[model samples]
Target: MDTGTLALLIPIMALSIPLFRIWTKHQKEIAEMEVAKTAERAAQYAASNKELEDRVAVLERIVTDRGYDIATQIEALRDTREVEGLTARSESGIN
Candidate 1:
């Protein structure tokens, strides 16, 4: 209410206005940077998820195909032949 106090308060209030604006501006910049970082991380996660989905789809196709069992049986027969051939070669000492 007194002139002395009013004069003192006036200059303090004037100085605080710019300081508050600067503080708020810095905080807003920090928030924007965090948002950008979050978006980049989300994009990376999406790409990884898509790659995994593709791999899963390929595996599902292989597993569900009717020919898969036949293919596995053929591979087993080939493996048995290879093993028997190795055993025969070892027995005959044909290194």
Candidate 2:
């Protein structure tokens, strides 16, 4: 209402505008950094999930695919090792 009061209020309000702008800018920058960090974490999780999916796919194939006939091969290999062990023991005169 008075000229003296208006003069005092004007400078205070002007100074507050710049301080408000600085505070808002600082908050915006911090929010952007948080968003970026969250996005990075999400990307890492996605990559880890993809790798696990790939490993699961390989395990599924090993379990379900019957074309390899792995059981017979393993048995044959075991028989071969037994024969070799016998031969080695006889050569060494160890019974």
Candidate 3:
């Protein structure tokens, strides 16, 4: 209502507009960065899933193939471990 009060209010209003604009711009940039990070993480998960699927396919093939001999291979691995255990025990005089 008075000229003195009006003069003070004018500068305050003028300064607030630019500060609000700057704050909104900062918020927009943060949102964009979060979106980019989320997309990158999604891509990494997809690649990992693809690798696991490939490994599973290989395992399925090995298990289904007639000549693979899964039982024999497993027994062979167990035998090697038992032989190593016996050798270590004998060397340590643990009977």
User: Judged by TM-score, which candidate is best?
Assistant: 1
Q: What alpha-carbon RMSD in Å does predicted model 2 have with respect to the real structure?
A: 3.8
If scored against the real structure, what TM-score would every candidate get?
A: 0.75, 0.67, 0.68
C-alpha local distance difference test of each model: 0.95, 0.96, 0.96
Ranking by TM-score: 1, 3, 2
lDDT of 1 by residue, 1-95 (tens): 99999999999999999999999999999999999999999999999999999999988887788656968888999999999999999999997
Candidate 1 off by > 4 Å: 67-95
Find the candidate with the highest lDDT and give its number: 3
lDDT of 3 by residue, 4-75 (tens): 999999999999999999999999999999999999999999999999999999989888884668888899
Clashes of each: 0, 0, 0
Give residue 82's lDDT in candidate 3 (0 to 100).
100
User: Considering summed lDDT, which 10 consecutive residues are worst modelled in model 2?
Assistant: 62-71
Question: How much does each candidate deviate from the true structure in C-alpha RMSD?
Answer: 3.4, 3.8, 3.8
Residue 76 in model 1: lDDT: 97
lDDT of 2 by residue, 1-95 (tens): 99999999999999999999999999999999999999999999999999999999998897688656878889999999999999999999999
Q: Pairs clashing in candidate 3? A: none
